[model samples]
Target: MTEAAQKQQSEESEKRERSPGGKFMLVLLTGFLLAIPLFASWLLIYDRQSQSEQAEQSIVTGWGGQQVFSGPKIVLPYKAKVQGSVEQDGKTVTRTEIVMQNLYLSPEAMTFDSDIKTEVKSRSIYEVVIYNSNVTGLATFKLPDDFARSGIDPATIDFARAEIRFGLSDARGLAANNMLSVDGQPLVLQPGRGLGETGNRGFFAWLDATDLADGTITVKYDVKFRGTESLTMVPSAGQTNWSVTSQWPHPSFTGGFLPKNEVTEAGFTAKYAITNLALGSALTSTQASQQVYPQSNNRPYTSFDSSGEPSSVTINLIQPVDLYDQVSRATKYGFLFIGFTFVAFLLFDLIGGVRISSVQYILVGVALILFFVLLLAFAEIIGFALAYITASLATIGLITAYAASVLSTWRRASMIGGLLASLYAVIYILLSLEAYSLLIGSLLIFAALAGVMFVTRRLDWTRTLQKRPSS
Candidate 1:
């Protein structure tokens, strides 16, 4: 045969490859190839998500980061004697040295009222949560007459240079913390860790408790700070009450201790009533060098900060919906869209007396996959809801128009259009009802299979595509 004759024979043989089994294999094959773009779209969504997170992190860098704070603990210093054997005169002799040691005293009563002002900040297409926390609180401390038990005489306790300490996760958050009043005596704030683990990332003030040896020492403070995302507080007194109110509508409470909380569209109010009895520890320690919150590995004096730890109460200011997350979820349904579109085309070609080539199948499938990319792109600018509608409409229009020519009738093409629109709508519903998505998706598949079974129940499968005419 001539080359042209052989080419015509090959074309005729390819056209003969049609009907139910042929279309099923072709769709399976086409679906396989379409996986590439669907996978690529998923990767693109993650890459954009990572970039958004990096942008938010950069914004937080300029502002203060998450803030975790503790204390109104007293640091009382006293003289102590240490005895050691020394080679003083070419012979081992007992040497006595006097050293100044510190004793940490927690408050008998402590209370704080925190008011947080929140604002949304955007960089590029990313947004971050930032807040200013204004804290006003008071603490009452009482000295016990049991100093002699720690090997320090009451007369040896130096009350003149006693210090009151506090802890914060980030020192940069101390925006307006400078001076405070202790028992009506105005005192200056000095930044540094005085004692042990509790000394991390906070400020302290020197107070003379000599006159209050037989009475109670009181401290009152009003300070302001800046932070992003989360906040944490330590219950550092025998009895503690912390009340926090914020205008941020979305708040997540986490950590070791949960609060009695109320949430509203306007904001949230969280109140914590804690006591040394619930703290699972004592109120005071002699020469406290041990970690105050042992399980709280994230406090910054040790160079760590986490959203929630078991030893402290944490509050997270959160975004109501994560756009990237929703986009990623939408991509997970990419294959469903492609499969349904391919099946719709296959069914119409098998019984509607229309012919659909593998190329048209591929084109429609590609359009379905492209929807994810479009959704992700628009979601960054317009948000998830509007972006879903925009992307779905664009994709549905492109495929429905292509289907009109491929199916050879406006009637069959309209069915394809309606099918695509319905699939998109069901996908949106699945995304919304995350808890029931699996159940609904399974029922949708079962219904599709039942419909296909009913439609082709009486068709003579033994017959090939040559028997059916393009009516």
Candidate 2:
């Protein structure tokens, strides 16, 4: 062959190499990219160790051993009635009312150390609710019957109390699942002594009801208590001024012997006299209390189970939140974005035969991969929207630059960028949609694939794959 011809042939061969190795690499990359959504879904469902951490961090309240307060002894006498009618199969047969008196006596204690004033003063606030309504009852907290039964004299209890308020209520059609609220708030029990030395240190505020006509109501059972509670709250840096807490016991309600599920919560508010510093305020607390089931012709107030014998009670904290589920929800749309991007790339190459260079493909893949990391990081800092924007912008910039350089056209590069930006926007919209996202995203993917198929219908795949003009 002539030397010039030989050189020309060599150049042609180089141009037409097409690189089977590159195709193989593309196959592998495509497979891996396609697998990302599956892996993400699996991670969301199975590997949510992160959610557990977030839940622990977010829901827990008290840490260090801090005795915020112990109030003075208070005597309380309360009366309440439960009324309701049960109708089954279109027949109103049973109408019942239960009335009872609660005699409560309690010993309270509080701590203080202040240069501003020698003595510390604190006021306790009590609130209550029932059947999503407020039921008023006695405001004063009393000593447990167990204390008097143990032969512990009431005179031995020290005194540092303030004025107490009283309340009464009539609740109708009370059921086990009926909702109870304290101080116009839901109850979330945490591990700590709320008031007394025993686990029973908590207080309850409720409404007064004589009939269902009043609906349930809420009342502020405030006790103008004076004592030292400076020890309950110590200043800590980088902590919220007002602390919030919650807990969910395994079985929910405590059997009648303890703080039952019927009483949603017991919370106290402490204020220091000298510095007037208020701390240990319960924004909300909740717990499961047991239901009192009266057996046929038995002691009226006796709690018995379905077996009709003295039933054992099992209680658990009602921690309703699953942090992992929440975080997973935030990432679901990101996974969808990545999955459809892979599908689009596959469709374009299979039909248009306008193959992207390996480097360009790698750039796009990297952009897709980094999106989740960016989302997780930015979400932790600035929130979901900012995190998504930062991630999408970064990926868009990377892919656009690579597209322009590899496709050798500014217009093509911008086109890819706009398309990617649009896709990201759609993903964000889906993420925000919550319940409707799955349906909308399915339709979107279908439409996108249809467009790709329609546009590339006439392209000659073999010719485009061969050494041809860049039409």
Candidate 3:
């Protein structure tokens, strides 16, 4: 080949390599490749969060788990005769036998007052919230005068063997030295709930009602217990009223019923009132009452279900700020950060006569993805805000220094640093204002698009193919 022809071929190849079209395609491909590391980093953050949850569970298990209170109820044992057919001497014979059964009764009116004090228990990087609850209440039970209408004789009712029972979901949470009283008489509490109609795990106390002609009994008790996360109470009385006060500022009131009260920064005060009519008669029927027995083989009562009636309220002690959740949210915007910064570099390459290779762009993207890893690691030691700030500063400094070498000017490199700083600030705001993040992010993107359009309004793309000397 001629020397002139070889020179022309070299110039054409050089022009194509530095063309705006070629650089744009390379940036797009680099951005796509960067997603692999970004997603891998997100998975790592998720795995760490799961580990944190496991740590919290361990802490809560050691400290009594969550608690649910079913009742401070009156239960009585009675004898009934059942007639059945049996085979005797190769012939069917009718026999009558006496069988023992339990009659469960709830109070006509009941009132509960609970004072809950919460504390945080931490293990390593995870923390669990637990509470010591002091509860006191009064319940009044009166046998209906027409009780014999249910195929049972009132005179046959064994009032002497009557017992007062209370149900607790986790008996381990019960504090020692609890007290119970029936008609101003102190009674001894036993371990297992005497009434099979109630739950199996709880305390019961015997009370003789033979001398009481009117069949009216008043009971009172004061209980102290410890639990974690949440506390729920079942309203077993015809008319139930509950007043709960807690020192925890962030209490999430959940369950079938909501508190008709207010929550404040210092604490929360919740009140609940439930009526028998709302609870439905099915809950008070003999079949439903018998279902609570430990040997009934029936589905257990849940705080929120059709059969259980769920006439209850629950309060969850929640953390005000969850750092893991915030960090995860920040990582979701990783692509935007990388793409926008790459676009800024491209603009500098196109307008400012700076030459940045595809490899340099990929290196900058990798550094941007590393920021999330740094944030996650630091967040486990420090908090979200400090970790974010530290990671952002470190990344900005590294990328800015690299930019200075590639762009050949400290002034241009400073511009890239300022742009990154502004982006980090915007992301922090978005993270803080979660409800308005979409609106703010959309407006910021629109403004960026407008700025880019204005800056390149007079540029001619045809001139991009013109040959220029290598820098």
Candidate 4:
């Protein structure tokens, strides 16, 4: 072949590789490959979240887990006779047998006042919120005047076997010097709750109902306990009032009822009032209490199984912001960051007559993905905001320096650096406005598309590809 013909053929081959269609297809393939790292980053986020949860659990277990308090109640045992028929000597014989059963009673009126102080316990990069609480309460109990009208003889009641029970979800959380009194007399508290199925894990004190000739009693108690995250109470009384104050600022008031009075910030004070009508007549009868109390067991009272409406106010000691959660949310936008950056590089290559190879595109994407890894690592040591600033500055600086060599001009590289900085800023905004992230992201993508279309409007793809190489 002639020398001129050989040169022309080589030029044609180079134009084919750099054609708009070929470049577009290569960009798509690169995007597909970028998914691998994106998925890997998500897996890392999931692992980190799991580790954080495990750390929280370990801390809580050591500090007597989340607590739920129920009842400063009275339980009375009684003997009853039931007539039944049984086969005897091949014939049915009728006999009366005595059975022992306990009657559960809630206070006619009850009040609880709690003062809680919170602290942070940390292991490695994880921190858990735990608390110490001093609780004081008073409860009044009275037998209904017509108690004998409930088809039971008052004479058969075992007033001597009466007991006062208090339910604590985790008995391990009870402080050593707990004080409980009835009628100004200090009572010896025992381990078992003694309220039969009406109580969970807790301590009970023996009481002599016979001493109260008027069939009325008043009791008071002081409790010091330690727990993690939250404390819950059951309003199993005719009228229940709870006043809870805590040094923890973020309190999640959850349950069947919300606090009527609440002041939140730096610390919180929440008061709840529950009427007996709202609690139903469950506390009046053992059979009813069994059904009513356990029904609330599935509600978000604590980690333990007990029954009531979300009737308790829970003051949760929560972090003002979750750095791990923020990092995870930012990582979800990894693909958009990689895609927009590559598109910008491609635009510079096509419109500015610069050359950026597929290998260079891959390298740039790898660097973008590395930003998240750096963020995760640094966030564990420091926090999200500082880690984000550090990782972004490092990645942008690295990529800008690399681009200067690839594009052969500081001006062009500086533009890329500015673009990257703008992108990082947009991501931070999206992270901050979680509620509006989708709207902002959609607008950004639309604006980016409009800019790309406007810049390429006058260019002829075929002619650009066939143009002589620029020196």
Q: What's the TM-score of every candidate structure?
A: 0.84, 0.43, 0.83, 0.85
Candidate 1 whole-model C-alpha lDDT, 0 to 1: 0.80
Question: Is 3 or 4 the stronger prediction by lDDT?
Answer: 3
Error of 4 at 410 (Å): 2.1
Residue 95 displacement in candidate 3 (angstroms): 9.9
* Residue 346 alpha-carbon offset, candidate 2, angstroms: 5.0
| Of 2 and 4, the candidate ranking higher by TM-score | 4
User: Candidate 1, which segments miss by more than 4 Å at Cα?
Assistant: 1-11, 78-101, 143-157, 194-199, 211-214, 286-308, 458-463, 467-469
Highest TM-score against the true fold, candidate: 4
> lDDT tens string, model 4, 1-471?
999999999987785556775786788799889989888987998899898999899877846778888778777776767688999999999999777655777888999899999999998889988889999999988876667667766677788878788777777777889899988989998995533322357788888887543667889999888888888776778888999888787778776678865656678888888887775544456432322335333121111124733445566667888887898899889978887888788877787677778899999999999999999999999889999999999999999999898887888889889999999999999999999999999999999989988988886666436443534
Ranking by TM-score: 4, 1, 3, 2
Shift of residue 374 alpha carbon in model 1, Å: 1.3
Report the lDDT of model 4 for residue 107: 84
Every candidate's CA RMSD: 4.6, 17.9, 4.3, 4.8
Instruction: Name model 3 segments beyond 4 Å from true.
Output: 1-19, 77-102, 144-158, 194-200, 207-214, 260-265, 281-283, 287-311, 453-471
Q: Which ten residues in a row have the lowest lDDT in candidate 3?
A: 282-291
For model 2, residues 366-430, the per-residue Cα lDDT tens digits are 57766666666555556557767887899888878876665556776687788889988877677
Give the whole-model CA lDDT for all candidates, comma-separated.
0.80, 0.40, 0.80, 0.79
lDDT digits (tens) for residues 1-471 of candidate 1: 999999999899767655577667877998999889889989998898888888988988857888877877787777777788988669999988777666778888999999999999988888999999998999999875564465557687788988888877677777864558888999988887633344356788888888656788889988788999888886767788999999888999987678999999999999999877676656666652233224233232211224433367789999999988999998988888988888788777777767777888887887888899899889989989999999989998888788778877777778888998999999999999999999999999999889888988887664567534554
Which stretches of candidate 2 lie above 4 Å from their native place?
Answer: 1-327, 343-354, 357-359, 459-464, 469-471
Using lDDT as the yardstick, the better of models 1 and 2 is: 1
